[model samples]
Target: MGDGRGGGGGNRPAWLQLYDLVGKIGEGTYGLVFLARPKQRKGCIAIKKFKQSKDGDGVSPTAIREIMLLREINHENVVKLVNVHINHADMSLYLAFDYAEHDLYEIIRHHREKLNHPINQYTVKSLLWQLLNGLNYLHSNWIIHRDLKPSNILVMGDGEEHGVVKIADFGLARIYQAPLKPLFENGVVVTIWYRAPELLLGAKHYTSAVDMWAVGCIFAELLTLKPLFQGVEVKATPNPFQLDQLDKIFKVLGHPTPEKWPTLVNLPFWQTDLQHIQGHKYDNAGLHSYVHLPQKSPAYDLLSKMLEYDPRKRISAAQALEHEYFRLDPLPGRNALVTSQPGEKAVNYPARPVDTTTDFEGTASVQQPMSANAIPGGVTAQSMAGPRPGPRQISMVGMQRMPVGSMAAFNIPSQAGMNLNPGGIPMQRGPAGQAHPQQLRRKDPAMGMQNPGYPQQKRRF
Candidate 1:
């Protein structure tokens, strides 16, 4: 395949032209995901380009966090960061993942709105097992995936990534070690609907139990093809209390008490909203209340343990993997992609949408201001103290069009006046494609110098 650039193609990296944009995979507040097909590879890769913050320069901390974790992990159940690329001109980062056809959110949406057929028991069992397997790996590593929802879990079918349900999107993943700042201090975590009760109550020091609660909600959603605890999110207020969200949970699971959850009333926000629930009684509708299933089912037990009121009592990912729900009848298949409902073939999920004519090859130019104040109790990937991981190899093309205006001190000629392409050199950058801290030229606090994956040019100014 020829480089997207019409003329002087070999002047840039050879790998740049290997990728053919299939379509856009998905878009979020964070970045845009694209399904790109490689010339050499048979299947496609999901390229997620995190949106550069309007307030700051360069990649956000979440992008760094994702690259750091995904690069270190080598698991089948987890989405692997296949490659990293940057829209050097815009300073936007792109992460290439093992492409997947469907996510649980899309799957649920398909079953509910697109198709009259519901997902089969075998498929559900397979999906749950794989989900737990991925979660167990993360929890064992002491990494809390603060955001675990249907949208974050990917499913592949009859491809290289086929029959596998990979856990993707690590925007809210945090490595928790003792003696660190309280988790909740990092602002709000997890989506409101799937959020654990403890988090809703504002627990400062929490556990991986938060993720388990979301899994339970996901489990319920899988059974019913809809969000289990669907709560209307309210806009932020000065003194915010999610009364409507809390009402959704209470109406179904009843209220927590001192006996059931000893630390129930001790949360910071709970104390502030104490008067609201002073003597109210919300009956425990149980799991069967939301989804009609047998009362004496092992699935119910697993769901109960996962949605346990007390984080202390919530089922760990490892424990959930061992539940009897998995042990019943036909065990989970190795791949949920091929797993089908009885008398039905696997449904073909559509390809992701992509936008062509995009130059995802550029570097971010940042000039930090010394007036920027240092953040306190901040747990950023760069701020964490540990043996730093090696640099991530990303495809990059720049130097031809350097942003050498007033923003940066370096001086270089424009694309027409000069030639600066590496031609065939493999692009490399610091961890998550950032520059090493030692090499960073810090003028501001937001340019997170931990991963400076930009190009080094010889200027003639």
Candidate 2:
């Protein structure tokens, strides 16, 4: 393979020749992410390298699904799939995407730990607005981002699209237009901390409301620099219903009842596991206590709607963008870093750190390739060890946790909103770069070079 500096890489894959593998960004159960600079183009790119199928057959179903879904859609708020390449020698898959400098996870950590202050109100509002805007686009098209969390939400660094929110990591995203099978049959979805109540209660049939619940949790995390509902996960085999996660939510929002959620009685777990689920009683409704927002504040009202107990009543992304909260002072702008208020300095968040030690070639050689099983949401067998830099960038693929929050009383219906149909747009790629091969090596043991259990399989809608 040709080194990134324009050498003889004619024998390698097209990607290895087109871009210089600068460094390894992060790794998960399925693959590793590399940060590369195009030899001919002026900008950088994030190349996700999927491990060869365990059976060495074809591409992993998750990768195939992501490619299919991403290829069919295009929006500024959504992450762009630049290109896809396959290494026939190993049957590995490589997906190239426009490089995003920072994710919500690091941005939040910077504010909480390094800067020692909460993210500015303007930034928060703008971030949330863009999030809903992008989500509305997806929901309108019948797509549900099964995994929506801070780590997967990318914010571009200094560039033409700086501070623009791009919803990345579509490995768990799905089109919810009448599926071939129940979504639950594929097993758990969403990170544990951002999971929906319906999922925790074991609802077999679900909708885009699950995404809205995650957005609500993200909104709360933006307001309060911590996970609104920080419940530890129970990582048992076959994924048992998360009792701790549900209890954590009930303590804050009060337990759900048949009156509040009419369809609550229909859930599989609610019917079969009623004793344990109802073992403890909670009656206090106190969202006001944690959020500290005034009773009638637009922010509070909008949040309450998003976290509604009944998934059917959960605020749709389209409806949320029109909520009074977004209409209040400091109106949302395209760039989240800049405050709308005059005389306010743009918040300069630190850029995402890149590990240059391990490039694509380096990673492939050291790591043991194993096919990800049919499990969906769980932490990797090993987390990146020695951390000596900025916020760690781990893929939140197939992780689970229900969205957490206390709720104030509000009336709701028994059904969710309707999906909108929008015309599809073709993808536009940046100018192509010249070919270069780079031989890189990795010395980090904690980078998760070995693939563990398989994540969930992809299902067609």
Candidate 3:
């Protein structure tokens, strides 16, 4: 199964050769995603190849978990797993999917420098509609997209103006077969920026509402073009009123109390040991503070409801779709608005042909040095060793070399110089690693300087 070049590890089954791999589309901890074309089909497809461990364990459990969940779920807004391929020799697994143009993160980055024509309100509504629709489908199926963010949403077919948006990456999604429990012992489930307050408060039993909180944050970011609640420090601290962002939310929406948020005091972090800081309001604020605010319109109201402090009070994804925001003139539609941005055009490319070699042989290529930034915590890795249970950690080297489609499947960041290597492995260091905290602290240029409602936390899968 191994190509003489050490490229193909004979990890892919013979039947999988029916599809031609064009090139690397993305890379992740466990696998490489490639732009592939089925020999019999006309359009392109995304082929995710999970690196197999030398031992019996083929694909990482994290990948298996994602495949298992994605297989059973189908919705227009959700990315579909077209097929799976298993290679017996190396225990590798390949997942095929419909190809997409770009992820929301890429779109945001492309438009970061431009302010006048930023994603219009209509476009935001359409994307939000699709996101909520996908979430609704997942929640209805008793699944939770623990990680929901711009990076995870892939733009397909040509969104309303440019291409359609599809919710991708279900690696962290879990089924709600029983009452909710602490999925992670350390309360480190979601990403920092889009994480919900309840998660930070250590609430063991939660619901789909957690996803709504993230959606709210994303909506605000869409309007403001920056993360709503990126805390100053990595280590959690009780800075109740210091963050001007949250204070602005209270100023516009009013403060919340135990009565307003009944479970606020019951959260794991809200015990008597947790200090109760008095509320504060923003005074003498300038126009710059609220310039990005959506006109006092229905979209604004729905955004407010989604960002509600009380998870119970949050609007359901289905309910949010029915809101008037989506009914506005030039109704939000599927497909992205096209532009002349670099890498935006859909290119017609040929697929990479499969090698006709018969025997599986190991090549002598030297393993590349690991990247300085390892895969983040919670990401699973594919081991060359025996099968390990639960989630495995993907290595940084594996990620950089991973195929494009696989990278999309795993929601890896697309920044050119960012070190996506997992586990802090210091093979290659990039500007992202050298970026100062202050540089990271700058607000998302797309969202601008205006504080929009609650600061959204990152939702990790």
Candidate 4:
């Protein structure tokens, strides 16, 4: 395999060489994302190719974690992962995802440049509602998107008049079933600007509330068209520490003493940063500096709760979704949430049909080789490890074969006795090693796929 630096390699991996490179979309410390069209897929999609080294340290495990989490998460508000392609020759891996035209960060940046009115309340509320819905789904599935920022919140169209918001970029996400070990003992997560106080204070056993903190910061930025906490720059003039903006928050929302936030004094990093300050009276006199809203507005209150210093007291994503702030009149009713636009149709991807005679239920099966055209350059077939199977083929009795790509729609029922395939994909089964005949039927295209037109349902505000 060739090292990924500068794209130098003897022979480009089959997958990389197969897709016609259009142009770069975004770049980060990890890798370059490109706007490309897959040979099999109809529309243009964003393909993130992570850099890898011959020794394997450049690409982080976070990338694999994102792929694993996304495959099981079937939510409209979350970005969709089309497929993953690994190039063993170059040690590079590619993640193909649905493409969004714009992100919340660009929208805010553009709004700032115009000096025009920032995002209006209706739009902000709508976006916030979608964000909470996405988070709700993630938390329900025991997944935590540690990195939540404007840059990760993608918008599908133009504005509130037509655009839809969806959460993307799960590079820093993890399945949070149990308490995380100490950051010092393992790894520190979350982006700095949106990091929760609990994380900054080095709290190890935290909950999903940490993500809500980032949501609060993102909401504040959308309203003010500026970062909530622009960290102190080291090279600034009148001494860097002297110009610290920690109090900017306190000034807007009244100072939180040990009485208001009892946990603040106990945080590991609080004394060094906030204890010595004197006469630091918070200035909540005017609301104009924070968001262009009355102090008593419901949105304002919700934002405050989201940004609460105490993680224990923070509002949950599920609770926030039901808040009155998002229930404004003139929107659809709660039960009538629009999953798809009125007339939009679902797109079906081409897939090869699998033989139903094979014991795919309760046992792992070797994945069939992807079509040469489906994969660009050809890929070598890899078998997953699993329990040994007794060598015997049952007579073709009552077996059914479904059309290609038809079974992609239905989700396996929770009560179904399913086994993880060697490849980690789930396969459903019946009693005594007998494959369920019902699984062979074609499923409706709309069953499991997200609607492409409107990425998520508009909140019934």
TM-score of each: 0.74, 0.77, 0.63, 0.65
| CA RMSD, predictions in order | 14.2, 16.1, 15.8, 14.8
lDDT of 1 by residue, 1-461 (tens): 15443334455444456676443435676866655567786655666777775656655666755655665554456776666654445555567666655678878887898885677777787888878877776665556889999988777654344556778788888766432456776677888899988777767788888999999999988898988887887657532566777788888888878888888879876787766664668777776778777778888888888888898888877767667887776567656756444566767654333333333432211212111012111111100011123332221122121221221212223232121113211223345434333221322222111222111211110
Comparing candidate 2 with candidate 4, which one achieves the higher lDDT? 2
lDDT of 3 by residue, 17-65 (tens): 5655333445655556655456776655666676664343444656666
Candidate 2 residue-wise lDDT, 259-376, digit = tens: 9999999988888886877666887668767777786888889988888999988888767776777766666776788665679676766544455556675533333332212111
Off by over 4 Å in 4: 1-11, 53-59, 158-162, 179-186, 233-245, 271-289, 330-461
- Model 3 regions more than 4 Å off: 1-13, 51-58, 114-116, 158-162, 179-187, 232-256, 272-291, 336-461
Backbone collision tally, model 4: 1
Give the Cα lDDT of each candidate.
0.61, 0.66, 0.53, 0.54
Question: How far in Å is the alpha carbon of 109 misplaced in model 2?
Answer: 0.7
> Using TM-score as the measure, what is the rank order of every candidate, best first?
2, 1, 4, 3
- Give the winner by TM-score: 2
Clash counts for the predictions, in order: 19, 22, 67, 1
